[model samples]
Target: METKKTDKILLFKGIKLLIFAALSLFMGPTLMTMALSDKENSLYIPLLIVACLICAMAVFLIFKGIKIIMSSMFDKK
Candidate 1:
């Protein structure tokens, strides 16, 4: 069984995290837009909750991407 190399893992994780972050970022904005567009909608709370969650996930992903990128490019550890 061949073990995965660190650089390969970093590259794969960086790309995957960035992709997921992008999708989550889009979802968050769309949800927020939906919540804002219909002020009278009673489901705003749930939409807001989900939107916030998505946005938070996006932020986390971005941080992880940064970590992966920095470590892969410079840290060497």
Candidate 2:
């Protein structure tokens, strides 16, 4: 029973990492474009800041996920 729960937890973590990676991959580029567009708008600065933050966060999450997955894989052996 405990082993089953552990397997489920690991599966959930793997899925979460995958989801984060996908979101980061997709949002990072789109946000970069939006941030660089030259349009006179009131929300430009705020949006750009937000985009920067999201990009940073996405990067962090991706690295973290990769590290976790790699460690888990090696641990299996």
Candidate 3:
């Protein structure tokens, strides 16, 4: 792969990682707040769980992307 394409992939991966981190931070608190509130909502718990799972997946993807970029740096000409 060309260096430019590789760089773009790296940049995209980094952005995804940042997005996931933000979602994790936001969702955790939002869910907690909703659970504590008196109002009952059926969807909140499931959505919260999904959000947590997505956060975990995002972290995994970030690491994978880093590894790919590093390996690409060492690719034989």
Quote each prediction's TM-score.
Answer: 0.79, 0.68, 0.51
Considering lDDT, which of the candidate structures 2 and 3 is the better prediction for this target? Answer: 2
Q: Which stretches of candidate 1 lie above 4 Å from their native place?
A: 1-6
What lDDT does candidate 2 reach at residue 20? Answer: 84
* Cα RMSD, each candidate: 5.0, 4.6, 4.9
Instruction: Please identify which of the two predictions, 1 or 3, would achieve the higher lDDT against the true structure.
Output: 1
> Candidate 3, residues 1-77: lDDT per residue as tens digits?
45533455555666666566666667666665665563367776776677567657656765766665665455543
lDDT of 3 at 38: 38
Q: How far is 47's C-alpha from truth in model 1 (Å)? A: 0.4
Per-residue lDDT of candidate 1, residues 1-77 (tens digit) = 65434576777788888999999999998998999898889998899889999999999999998788667655544
lDDT of 2 by residue, 15-56 (tens): 698788779778876876886786577777887887787778
Output the better candidate (1/2) by TM-score: 1
Q: Arrange candidates, best lDDT first.
A: 1, 2, 3
Question: Considering summed lDDT, which 10 consecutive residues are worst modelled in model 2?
Answer: 1-10
Clashes of each: 0, 0, 0
Residue 74's lDDT within candidate 1 is: 56
